[model samples]
Target: MNKLNNYKDNEYEYYPICINGQIFNCFSSMSLKDLLLYLNFNLSLVIVEYNKQIIDKEDWSNICLNINDSVEVITITGGG
Candidate 1:
């Protein structure tokens, strides 16, 4: 596993990842769960696709994100 400190840019390090086809920069190493929280997602109401695979909710905390990794998040909404 690569440490968060592995990347540096004039005193800052950023990990670039793709979420829902958009690029985002994140600092420090974090799990999918953390990412969801950072994005203000309600865990119980969302589904996550990691690297083109549907990820089990139980595995969110164990899946560490990598640079350039692709993720897709879908929020479940109620409709009449």
Candidate 2:
């Protein structure tokens, strides 16, 4: 397991990740949970997708990101 500091210090190059065509680069060493909290996203439920592959949330803490990695975190919004 890489220490949080190990990832925190490196200057990671960012790539834009699109959420419903909204371009935003989420390239960082921060954990997915932290990011979601930062975004203040309604995370009662969320699905993680990386590199067009789906990853289980149970592994979010262990999911270390690399540069250019496209990860999508969609939360359950109020509606039908």
- Which portions of model 2 miss their true places by more than 4 Å? 1-27
For candidate 1, write residues 55-79 as lDDT tens digits: 9999999998888788899999999
- Tens-digit per-residue lDDT, 36-71, candidate 2: 666777666888776688877677677655544566
Least well predicted 10-residue stretch by lDDT in candidate 1: 1-10
Candidate 2 residue 15 Cα shift, in angstroms, is 7.3
Off by over 4 Å in 1: 1-12
Question: What TM-score does candidate 1 reach?
Answer: 0.83
Summing lDDT over every window of 10 consecutive residues in candidate 2, give the lowest-scoring window.
Answer: 1-10
Show how many residue pairs clash in every candidate, following the order shown.
0, 0
